[model samples]
Target: MGRAPQKVRNRDTNPCIDEGDASLKCLDEHNYDKSCCSAHFQRYKNCRKYWHSVMLQRRGDGVRPDMPTAAERQELLDAIGGKPY
Candidate 1:
């Protein structure tokens, strides 16, 4: 039997793609040296942490779709007027 096709996700569906990509790009530019990509990695980590908190808050408040849709995420960010982290 053939394996099932893998589903691809992008920044829209996965909010942290840009931060993740920046970290990866840093790694590539630095020839896979971890030290040079520390800031990128930290940024990615912060992004994930911020989103996770939002998800948890939504879940606690009994919001539908615990992970907000892209538009909803954007609205929340706009309302806050800055980065969650």
Candidate 2:
């Protein structure tokens, strides 16, 4: 039997994809050497940190499934790098 289809990584509208898409593509093409994509990890880390705080605030405010606005995502991407190719 064949394996299930793999989900696309770094897809559009994904939080860190704006800044990390190029790094992710390079890493995939180069066999995933961690050092080859440190920037991608860093951008994702920053995005995760911001989202953590956002989710915490949402929970305190009785909100469920906290999601970032497009502007919020763009800000994070700007802080890390430019828009995806």
Candidate with maximal TM-score: 1
Give the alpha carbon lDDT tens digit for every residue of 17-50 in model 1.
Answer: 7788899899999999999999889988999998
- State the lDDT at 22 in candidate 2: 65
Off by over 4 Å in 2: 1-14, 71-85
TM-score between candidate 1 and the true structure: 0.82
Clashing pairs in 1: none
Candidate 1 Cα lDDT to native: 0.83
Question: What's model 1's lDDT at 11?
Answer: 48
| Candidate 2, run of 10 with poorest lDDT | 6-15
Give the alpha carbon lDDT tens digit for every residue of 1-85 in model 2: 8997644453332455545666678689879898878877777677667666766787788865465556765686698796432
Estimate the TM-score of every prediction.
Answer: 0.82, 0.50
Model 2: colliding residue pairs: none
